[model samples]
Target: MKKIRFYHTLKAKIVIIIAMVIIFALQLMGANFITQTERQLVNNFQENQKLQMNFLENSFAPFLEMHENPKDTSEDIDPEEEINALISDFSGTGITSLIVVDSSFVVIGNSDTTQQVEVGQLLNDEDVRTTILQGSASSKQIINSQLNARRWRMVEPVYSSEDSQAVIGAIVMESNIESIYEQITDITLIFLRASLIAILLSSILANMVSKAITDPIKEMQTKAKAIAEGDYSGEVTIYGNDEIGLLAQNINELSEEVETGQRRIEAERQRLDSVLSNMSEGVIATNRRGELDVANNMASQMLNLSRDELAGQNILSLLEIEEDYSLRDLVDRKEDITLNIEAEEEDALLRASFSVIQADSGYISGIVCVLRDVTEEEKVEEERKEFVSNVSHELRTPLTSMRSYIEALIDGAWKDPELAPRFLDVAQSETDRMIRMIQDLLHLSRIDAGKSELQKELIDLTALFTQVLTRFDMLLDSEEYRFKNYKIERNIINEAIFVDVDSDKIVQVLDNVMNNAIKYSPEGGKITCTMTLENNQVLITVKDEGIGIPAEDLAHIFDRFYRVDRARSRAMGGTGLGLAISREVIEQHDGEIWAESINRDGTTFYIALPYIPYEEEEWGWD
Candidate 1:
């Protein structure tokens, strides 16, 4: 997928490496061949020069001997002329110059006629003088001054044929040796051309061979790119039964495995999403960097943010715990923490349980926090503690009163007949109050535990309410409550509205409401009982002219032990469980009950019971 330079490619590398090896080999071979050829050429030329010098030495030996001995001759022989004539005869045979010098280093014969003045002069050339004095041969290569060519110069001592050791004269010869070097140069050129041709051919062949190896690899690279792009359907084409082909097969297999793994991962992700979405509690997951990686719907809702908004936010800062705790602190924490989160509508208490996501290598990868809304749970716990304390206070008040009255009777108050009777009566009254409170508590307990069962029967709801009002009317006009005058006004429907209900529980509920009305009503206040049938249900309302409940306490009126005026309700013998019990009974009957009040004006309680229309035949009363 990435762009690669030509020089960095495998094909280019192979070609370059092969080219380098060929060049090195050719250079080494060329150097050795040229060196050996030059050495051979020089040796051959030197040997040929030696033979020429020997011939010249032998020819001049007799002449030199005759001159030295002053021999009686038939004619006067000019040995120098003879030597010159002999040198002139051999001039065109690759020889540059030749000269014969006497034993005292005096030049006798010169091959170049232009320099004939030095024929009898002393040959001051150091090579010639050294050869003549030492009676040895010496040779050196030099460039010819006339022809500007390379040549070998040789000096040999002329020896006597009779006395082989005696030095007679020295012969100097210079021969052109340029043709040998020219031959070597031609060979070197041929070798260079051959090397060039070889390199060109090798490069082409190397490119071809490298292509054979690299083509499949390039295909595999393409396949890898496809895989990276989530295209696992494509497979590499195998070129041969070599390692490349094997790798291609493995790649195909890996593609299949990767596809399968991707599907499984997707399924797991969907499953996780489902679980998180359906959960009642919130869930939050953070990556190793302490950044928000996942936040479920509940989590987002609980945090008053969207999932997208929560993503990539630092966990500590997201939860507003950065100042108090760090990421490492949370990772090492073993206990659940409480977070007071400000939700969309209100503040909520959440219990956050922490867990670490760990790998097999004991590496902590991330952290998971499960958030459960515990607002209601905490409220219930507080209410429970309050309930126990209230129960103790209520029972203790009655018990303390009864104990004091009994102790007074025991402390010789029995001797005072009047005090003893009054004390005993007070003790009995306190005992009765305690018993009533306990009974109310037990009844409420049963209702809360779902152990209370309703005994149902079809009855006249309007007639039942009229009977309850009749009892309150009689109680209000009785001798005991004559001072607190109350009037009952009935607005009953005169028709029987039949409904199914537990008659006894219904009576108990109506009595509690009527008693509270009587206790709170002003003198001669009207307690109006109204019953009507609406929307296939019977609605009964008990309205009284009394000090109404406060607005804030209206919502919690049905909660156990809750009273708008706690002291007033206790003085009126109210157990505070009456309305709570009434609501439970109404709900169990699939009906409804609620209250409406205006401060200092009046209060009204309504009870609606489900109504079923029936003919007399249905109840077999026809």
Candidate 2:
């Protein structure tokens, strides 16, 4: 027995399946052909035997007539001799044996009786005896010991003419059937040989067909193995227009894409490596596994460890912190975390900022560590804070002294009626100055603390602008300030320009802006207030053709207590917090406020307020 390998290749399996199906089909056809041919041969043999039997029955009539008439009595005519002559004639006609049996089942004449036992000694079988007794013909095939062969035997009863009712004897004929079996066996052998040939051809054809299919797959496997070993230069050749050809095309395209992607990735990796090494700040990277996969030169130096020592080590352990503070924790938490890691060999204070590196799917893939030495930055910040505090304190000292002196004069100098009004006016002016300073401080504080709030609601912006312009209506009417150049369009409006806003705060902002415009403008200078709707928000602009703000002062106009000219601002009673407060109010409404100025062209302050109030809850903040 051949040892069958359990692991059959795809080609082998397919070939085996096809061959088995072909062999089975051929076997079925061969069996049907053999069976049909055998049946047909048997039928033909039976038909020939019937014909022979009919001839024998017809010839027996003449012999029976001769026996009845007792012919040739004077010419030495022997009846037994005549019967033997008839048997010999019948034997020449392809019958294997011919015998005449009497009414008592005794054989009288036979062609080959001498070589075997004579008629008197031979026992008559049931078929022959029954035929004579019934006076009818019957046929069967039996094995005869006298001839030592199988033979088809037929027996017919013969009657006498003198007594028609008397049955005389039976004429029996036997034909050998061995030749029919020989012909059938020869046909079967031919079918068996044809079937074997068909099976062999089918097996060879199946092998060829299987090879056609499996060869492409084998080539694909070879290419895939080569790709695994980093050889992306090969191309797959496609054959014929079928699924296999399409698969080959796809494989070729995939190889090209993979090669391109690999090159790009290599370039990116090299660029990142150079950036990390050259950066002044220390950079560290870790994979999702929480191990330090990459560290820059600065990072290695800051940690007082070689790159080899840091690589593949758990970042938390390498840093030697007690708590489980690591890059992994920062990435998993998705929140900014600060860790103070100290160098083992050096006295360096390293502040590390751990940020999550997220993929496009919003999954935290890794963490990026940006380590900076903040020792100098911290010192600078502290010094700036102290300097601001000192400046504020120094400015407050003079204001406080002025307030005290003005109060004393108002209380005592009123007794001198001649000097009372001047003292009272100076006291009020000093008080106003102090009030402006305090208000500026409060506005700055509100912006710094992020506590500014806007109570927004829909209001007729046309009406609001009209009211703002009315406050300066008296100044516009005076000849001391010519208003011909001024263009204040109250009629031109969005019928109901509405904005969600704090009405009181907006009014204060408008008042301060309009007052500054009026005070700075020359007698004939123009002041225009224009309103427009843009991007679902209302843009209200105040334009003034006056001594415009200096370009250098434009950026700092919104700063607390900041002024282009301190003496001029004091003379005009200008509180520098107006624009600062305006900015905060606009921002609270999810809007924006800014100023555009040139040295001499003029200045325009723009305030944009959203039509709808933004809900803070939607921002994912508590």
Candidate 3:
């Protein structure tokens, strides 16, 4: 890995550079200011010294001129005394280093007693002395050996009024310049020190100001780093109403918004998880890359794999499907598709359906594979189809036979009168069989379609049963039939047993069941018809002591043209439509019809009708 560089941040570097520049500028300014201040001090000192020298020269000039007359000088004044008086006068005027030189360029008088100077000896360095001898006023530069410093020397000539241009003694003055330079140095030092202190204080204050600005920025950086790494819990605290504080507040708001967004995303994720976990249909969802993203519990079980084992696996690999069975292709198709995935074992069959999950824009985003165990449902459907085909073939066989036989007799067998009558009877019976089959088909169709309508009315149960029994009275009275075991009971006798029903249909249902009972009964075996009302329903049961239906066939006995004993039923003149049609008519009145039987014990067909019609308001006598 490459090592990261540690570069100074923009704010820090900028602040540091600005402070340095300011300090540099202050130092330069201080240097210039000290130079100007020294110059001013020197100028002021020179001007003050020159003013003192001029005042001394003016004060002595008048006194020296008044005593210059030849006749007046000899009466009262000596030269030495006069010279001393002139030096005293110069000292009294505060002129330091006052000296008097004659016009011959020689020192004439001096203020210091230890140094008595000659009046007229020629001065070797004669710049100032020559100026005074030529009657000119002048200033000179001289070194004071005692103080080891420079001095300003001025010279002036004293002349008589009659000879203004004549040579005369001169006055010279010298003043010290070292004290002025010293004061200038001291003041310059003071200014330099003050400038340095100001620069130092300013640097410290600038650093503090920079820190105040950049510290919050640093905090913001820290918070931003945390957010980038998926931690949204940190906040930037702001302290004042400046730009930095406002920036911190904005950062804080942004963090809150991010946290809220994350929470909402989490909630949505949980909701999706719940939906997937609880879904009944096995859901195996794949991404656009054809990788399995999620698989619900049902999907895991359907694939016979653990949850963890299915995750992140290729969808095709997880399903153990061929490579050509691409989920990506299915999604690209954008239509629902059915795929049958056979089990690994030869005899086992497992089918999986792949559907494309589409977005609102109608693009397929992923694939959802729904798995189901459809073995039983597929088997039942196959059986139902086979049963229907068999029924059709069976019914067609009998109809074809009857039609062929009837046509054969009509074409030729009628030529013989005896054969014709017998053939006609057979044809009639076959026709009746055909009629019964058609009627049974119609009845079953009506019931299945829920279109069977019954003519409902209040019915007296006792009279209906009496009429049914009376219709079979001759069979009951015959000794050969042996009605010894016959019994009829009406438990709701005097109560009228009034029920809302289609009486004619109910009687027909009862008669059909009773006839079946009588036909199936053994000679002298019991035949029972019982009527009772219980729980607001009227129940009629007809039972026979005969060979009963097999347990397995009892459930399907009422199916159209279904016979438990086909040959025996035909021999007994049964069209196999009686029970089916009866069941339809009974059920049309909002009733139930069923049969109970055991092998060789007996068969009982029970019919139950509700006392109140399903449509009570439309029912008569309601």
Candidate 4:
């Protein structure tokens, strides 16, 4: 930063301003005094000239009386010679010249004898003509170029003694007063010299006063700079025990407090940095302007952002909070809020604690948010609920049926051997259903707990499919034939397909798929079975011509206890756990199974398993 110069300082500028104002006032007073004195002197000189013109007017009065009456008493004298005698009589009254004009405006008299012969010339000067008409006096001053002096010309009318309003002629007087103006100019010079001396003295005094005031301030400024550089030892050495010295004392005290506070703040900042960086929960704070000002390391990681990227971002826009709430709303909250947030790559459960950053006076300044990731906790809670519901539902039906059958046996159905045996069989079947459900639940729980493993083997898929289909074909021989008139059409390649998998589990998967197909197929409907080798994998498709599963239910077919037609599944002894277990088995074998269906048509279940390729020599007839 550039240091301010002395001339630019407040004290120096104030001194200059006060000096200029004082000088301007002094100069204005002197100029006005000179101007008024000169004007008064000129006015007195003009008054004196008017008095001299009045004397000339009186001298010419007798001749003017004679011209107005046109009497024979005035004709005895020569007209030219009488005017010459009249003008020459007042030559000593400070009059430069005297001229007389008749009412016809012809000059008739002159104070000089040489101009008397030429006095009959008409005087057409406007001022002389006005004097003749109005019977009054008028004067004008001009600089006489030939004489190089200021002079005044005065014209006075000479009224007739007989008719006072009638003017027969007028007197014109010229006077010189240039010497008075010269005297006033000399007086003005003296005033200007005095004003200049006064201004010089004022300037010196203003500088002394300004320096006395600014010296203390300048010393305090230097001390302040030292304090800014973290040197708080120096104090301002002021001259007197005045306000400036008191101000210097206060500045010294402020410097000490600031140094102490700075050290304390530094230590607190280091501690805060350590705590924020090591904290597990994400912490983000926004300024009152709603832009993010502080975000810890954990916050950056949780938001999938860099520290620089998160800073200065609008908090409301970053979170995309609930439609009804915003960052301001969050700040207004008095309790913590848990919200669901969709992260960049996955969904997350966030428990957010909000606090309004405030001042001691209870003024809200900004907002602070502490966020905790509860994603795994929420997932565990949801899975626990689903597991309990599924397990209870799966066990309830078998328990209810077994209870009904046992009650029937106790209610005298045992008296008839036929009824008794029938009820006993039903009870036995329900017990077997319960056992199978419990076993399946245990296996699924193990798989979910990550404790289950597949028994890997190299199995021939073609022979396996043949054996599974043959068992279904044997099912038609039973009395109540579920596969009656249901033809099993096979589309199998001649080459044998071998896959690496757990043979028993893979067999169970295929058995579930085939059983679903046969169970849902219409009587006399064809069940198509195809096995093809493509891209080093065996694709086995079991398609049935029956009522297909609905579109919405297809995606969730492998979820435990999820049945498309629950009542129908229960009637057909379908546990709804078969497909879920099959999916788990296939995934363990590194294979995939999926089912496709459309409305009112049929469903096709496809299973893909990696196959081992054989050399040409081993196949012999490839």
Candidate 5:
């Protein structure tokens, strides 16, 4: 931890705040006490000055009357002498000066002996003149800055006894009332010294008390720092069971709880990692900023990158969807996206589903994406659609032909005897063609459903191939293919190649191949059928000297309803399902079938079945 500045520390702040409050309170109390005491003292001094000025006013009125009317003088005393005696009596009573002014502003007498020469002169004081004019008494406390002393000047107006309304003279008296201020000043100085001593003691006490509170807090702070650094090893020092001490105890308990919770969280994280690594589908998670947060093992493998490469990478760029979707678009998207990932060898199609991660406050925190491989599924769906279309087309062609012929016979063609029989025979042939196509479709459906069971028996491939060629030999002689002029050539082994197989299914496979050979062969072209044992299996091959299948179409030859040339195959009355069904039957017997062809040359299809060698005695042969 760094060193804290004194003013910035809690202890310093507490002491400073307490000192300010104490100073404010003491100043308020001292100021109020001084103001109240000064006001009361001034009031009492003013009352005493008024009483003395009233007595002087009575004593001077008789002398002032004699000066105004000398012809009716009752007593033979001098007016100035009596006024002087009255002024001199108050001189020792804290009076600084006393002056008596008769009517017309003439000074009658003076109490200060040094100012006795101004007895008959007019008084030069403006306050004395203003007091006589206004016929009112006034007092003013004046400070003589030159003399460095304070005094109170009081003025009184005297009226004659003979006529109460008549102004006789005015008395002005100055009293040294500086003692009032001296007393206040002395008390103020004492209070200031006491306040300083008190403030000094208070600061010391504040520092000590603040330390008691802050010491525990500092210890708790150190403990908190240790906890933050993953070292929850110690407890905060407790001073007492006060709020601060209770806080220390809570911090200790919290450290223990955090340690336990951290362990549980670590265990949960490990389990999640294991599950994610073993998952078949790829999983990716991103933060609110769309940066990658978690990329599981499968996700890394699927993307052909490592976890390190994915970390902190934007999710849009990582998934290669930056061009299509922004982060906000993915967050708001309602449907799954199909992504075609380009690779060096081949492209893969992955279906990505998105789920938003939301907090309890309804904030969208991130997104989780699950990727599933959907390549094979999409391919199968396309094939199924093509299969349905082909089946419909094949069935519709024969049905339409039969409907036309039958309608023609019913529309009086039967009455023409010649056209009627031909129409009926054509309809019957179309019906048979439709029936045959339907049967092939049902057989294929059974094979796809895994319901085609093979009835296995030991059979000789040599005899089976010879017998098949013999059937074709008789077929060429029949009227249907007699004009075709085809020949069947047999290249078979003399020794018997014995194998366990379903004889009926094998015969059907053979018939399908031989029919294709005869149908596609050129006129007088020879159909070479060969049978041999190779690689622990029996291989049967049929080669046709017809228009060779295109190299691109060879791979799909065994696919249902697939034709190299649909028009020619349809014109020849071929269902396009014979080779497909043949392939299925051969595959069910644990055999393989494929074709090799070149354009403008010839196509050869080979069927390889598992073969077994047996002794003649086992077969009951001579």
Candidate 6:
């Protein structure tokens, strides 16, 4: 720390200050007294010099007033000797020197005989020159610092006796102040003695005041140190209720307030922790610098990291966002923005939003992020869009065809009976296809909406299988049929295999499968229909000895509007919704329908129905 000198301490400082202030005061008082004394002495000296100069100027008045004629002889005007004699009279009166100068600053007379003298010489002194130029009496003291002697100069202007306004010359004189210096020396010794006595007296008072001030201050410091160390117990004794006393009271109150605030803050922290831990949405907070500050369990889970792992980590690194994008950019937005991020080790998509935590100054102090798992939501939205698009496409083809056919009939195709009948028939067929597609769409929609009710009833699987076979035989044996003599074989493992099912919907499902088999079967090929019991459920298979479905199309055979051979199925008067409808119907009965394909040999479709005893199954179609 700080290196404090002894003088900087309170006692030393107080003593020094008192000493300085007292010394300055005494010195000023003494200086003023000495200055007044010296001024009076100088005034007296100048007055005496003025009296002398007046006497000499009066003596030379006649010589100056009687302007000599240019033709006057030496006997008539010999005033130079009288001027020199007048200057000699003041030689022993402590007068250092006296010179009479004309208006030109040229010395005309000198008083001191022992010194060098010239009747006509320039003084080479500004004081004398100023006196001569300004024609005014001026006095100054020339103090010799080493010798402790002061020399005084008095410059007096002499006017002509005849015309007082006309200046004749000036007199410059010097005097010594050795006697005054001796008196001043004696006064200085007395003043020094008084100053020392005063200083000794002040030292005691300074010590007392310094201790009075510093004692309370040191106590306050000790109590403050305790408070700084988290100790709130202290007694601050008031000292005269001064500013320092008031400061002590404030410090005590501050300590009490700090202790109370710490407890309140702890309670608030616990409440916040409880709220954050149980929230469903992942909550994360970051400081203004975009480094992580607080995170909840859900936030850690969403980031696929532990709470410890996220500590001090930059939030930007959690998301593989676009180039030059950062968490600060998102947090600085006017409103919350959705940021797509990978969560769960980059396996799931999380839609994270950043909300700004602003201070009272309206500056962003931190960022609070809310994250939602939207992977499934995004998939569903895409599926909905695709469904709408597919439905529109499917409806448009038939609509376009119907429009064309109807226009053809209206635009004179009806005038020719053959073309008119052909166009009308095609239009009717297109309308029928549209109706079937709409019905299938409605059925599937009802199932998806969980509104489709199954009238499940008890039925014999063998009887149901035989009934389905009979319907197919009748369809093939009709008069307008194209296939000739299609061989069909039935293999029933048990005479009566009971199953709980929606009998009518199961009939529809089996019919669709058998029809599909017949459509792809080779001409006169054998179709083997078998029924067996496996795992307490009836398993039925429809194997077609025709061109089997390709391996690639097997999985998608049950998909809506999917066909192995699209062109061929369309030609066979198929709406391409049969297998899709069949799958839905089978599932409604708590059964499953799937296709097994062999590249070119044949394909078998299996149906598994849950077996329910006649006593337990619901007999009514309810």
Best by TM-score: 4
Error of 3 at 182 (Å): 99
Cand. 3 TM to true fold: 0.38
TM-score versus the correct structure, for each prediction: 0.44, 0.38, 0.38, 0.46, 0.44, 0.43
Candidate 4 matches the true fold with a TM-score of 0.46
Candidate 6: lDDT of 510? 85
lDDT of 5 by residue, 122-196 (tens): 777788777778787788878866577999988888887877777778988888899888988998999999999
Q: After superposition on all CA atoms, how large is the RMSD of candidate 5?
A: 36.5
Superior by lDDT: candidate 2 or candidate 5: 5
RMSD for each model, in Å, please?
38.2, 34.9, 46.9, 29.7, 36.5, 34.3
Candidate 3: tens digits of C-alpha lDDT, residues 1-622 = 2332433665556556766787678778867877787678767766776676566555555445533444555556565457667687767543666776555555656776554454444545565656665667777566777768867677666664467676556677666666666777787678778767876776677678777777788789889878777788867989888888999999889988888897896887677778999988788887776778778888776666777988888877666554666665665554444344455642223466677768899887677777766666665676589658745755665567667767878789778878878777776776777677667667666776668777777777778777778777666777856446554433334556667777777777877888888778776676777777778887777787888888889889987567888778876667677887887787677789998986648988888878753454654555
Indicate which candidate wins on lDDT: 5
Off by over 4 Å in 2: 1-420, 475-491, 612-622
Number of backbone collisions per candidate, in order?
1, 5, 0, 0, 0, 0
Q: Of the pair 5 and 6, which is ahead by TM-score? A: 5
- The TM-score between candidate 2 and the true structure equals 0.38
Model 5 misplaced stretches (Cα beyond 4 Å)? 72-76, 112-117, 261-622
Candidates 1 and 6 compared by TM-score, better number: 1
Error of 5 at 245 (Å): 2.3
Off by over 4 Å in 6: 1-280, 283-380, 613-622
Total backbone collisions, model 6: 0
Q: TM-score order of candidates, best first?
A: 4, 5, 1, 6, 2, 3
* Candidate number that wins on lDDT, 1 or 4: 1
Tens digits of per-residue lDDT, candidate 4, 10-115, equal 7778778887897788778877887888789889988998787677567667766555456644557555566668677777666667788888887777664554
What's model 4's overall lDDT? 0.81
Task: List lDDT for all candidates, in order.
Answer: 0.84, 0.73, 0.70, 0.81, 0.86, 0.77
